[model samples]
Target: MRNLKRLSIGPIDLDVAGGEIIALTGPSGAGKSLLLRAIADLDPNEGQLSLSGEDRNAISAPAWRKQVMYVPAHTGWWADTVEPHFADLSRAHVKNTLQRLGLESTALNWQVANLSTGERQRLALARAMAHEPKILLLDEPTSGLDSENAARAEKLISEIAKSGTGIVFVTHDVAQAERLGTRRLYFYNGGLHEAAP
Candidate 1:
């Protein structure tokens, strides 16, 4: 992204290579989520955005979003059952993803309203990985989980990055950022800067 502008953020530039994970941290309302939303083209913004050399405008919005997915902090479920949210639960990779995230296969049959916040978060992450996006924008992905579950989610995210999927995740946990980020970025005074070593 070059000269990316959204709300009070940016006129910014950034590059996330495949297999790289960039962790973003800052105070609340610092526009970290906005930046991700803009990158995903979920909101109106001005910039020159592209992926693998193709301009974002070159493709339809839906196509662009599929390749650059934004998984918000709170996932929205349109269906009553969790099974309806996934395109195909039978795919081996999809099942594997769920298992790796410490989710049971039976959870898919449960009612969405009955699942806890942490369960929904893991399920949402699984849903995004199923699509196999080139880049993933995660907003506080492990916020609702305990230490054990958070570690599982972290492991899965690292594995995804190793497989050549670039990731930009926002987190309040400093230790989590240090563990997962190839580079740490700080959002301050409406600008993005390299975090102190």
Candidate 2:
């Protein structure tokens, strides 16, 4: 596949493939998140964005969203206990994800209000993984964690990518990108620049 033409926002372009992790990095206001939104059809834009040879616009929003999920920087929690939020989740999968993220199984019963930011982040990651989306849109998912927790989170991401999920990860942390991404894309001036090897 070829990179689409530069969007109106600026002069960058990107060509992405399936089962590949593409890290997006740039300064703030550089439109990294905006680019993800545009690709996910959560924002207005003029250009071609396709998945598996089908144009993004041709698919219904909900269907596209289910297949290509976007997890924002600040994940939302609307319940008291974490278990309630994941009540529909498969017990085995939930337990495994939490364990992989370094969370004890007991954390499932903890109140959302009582959990720290890192815990919340891990919970969000777990929630997203439970859905088994084909494409993952992550926005600074490891931003609020301690080094140890961040490393665990990174490992989880690596494992997920290895399972064939296409990940478009947006982060300011270059090292994290280098560790997790198989390919890299830089967002700037409201567009995308493909990183060189």
Candidate 3:
């Protein structure tokens, strides 16, 4: 990013390489989500965001968004059944993904109405990965899960990051950030600064 500034959050000039996770931590209402939204191009902002030499401005928003996927804290389910949501991607593609996130393979056969909040969260993560985005803008991806499921999510996400996809995640838990982020940044007062390991 070259002078990436979002709703008074930053002129954050960031360079994230593939296989790296950059964690953003901050107090509540400190524009952490705003920054992620700006990076995802979901909101209006100023910046030069590029990926693998492709300029964000040069590409269409929909196309750019396809490559840089954003998964929000509150996920939306539009289908009546779980399998329909993943029909194009196929259940087999995400079979291991569902299990990796502590969901059963039979979860593919479950109905959308039957899924709990935690199941929705895990399913959203799987959906995002199915697209195989070049970058992931994850906002509290495991906020709805229990401790056991959260650990599974963290581990699965770490493995996905290792596959050369850049990830920027926001979390209120400092410990969670430390565990997931290869580098960490503090967000406050509309500024971003490096955090100590």
How high is each candidate's TM-score? 0.97, 0.86, 0.93
Better of 1 and 3 by lDDT: 1
Judging by TM-score, tell me the better candidate of 2 and 3: 3
Which model, 2 or 3, shows the larger lDDT? Answer: 3
Question: How many clashing residue pairs appear in each of the predictions shown?
Answer: 0, 0, 1
lDDT of 3 by residue, 1-197 (tens): 88888767777888888899999888889998888888889999997999889888898999888788999998888888787777768567688788888888888778888889899999999988887788998999888999999999899888889998899999988899988899999888887889733
The C-alpha lDDT values of all candidates are 0.92, 0.80, 0.86
Please name the candidate that would achieve the greatest lDDT relative to the true structure.
1
Clashing pairs in 3: 5-10
Tens-place lDDT per residue, model 1, 1-197, is 99999999988999989999999999999899999999999999999999999999898999999889999999999999988888554567777889999998787798999989999999999999888899999999999999999999999999999999999999998998999999899997778999743
Predicted structure 1, TM vs. truth: 0.97
The TM-score obtained by model 3 is 0.93
Instruction: Report the Cα lDDT for candidate 3.
Output: 0.86
Over 1-197, each residue of candidate 2 has an lDDT whose tens digit, in order, gives 12333244543356555678899898887677766766666776666677788877788998888778888888888998999878877999989999999999899899988988889988898888877788889999999999999889888888888888888899898887788889877766565667623
* Deviation (Å) of 58 in candidate 2: 3.9
As a whole number from 0 to 100, the lDDT of residue 35 in candidate 1 is 95
Displacement of residue 65 (Cα, Å) in model 2 is: 1.3
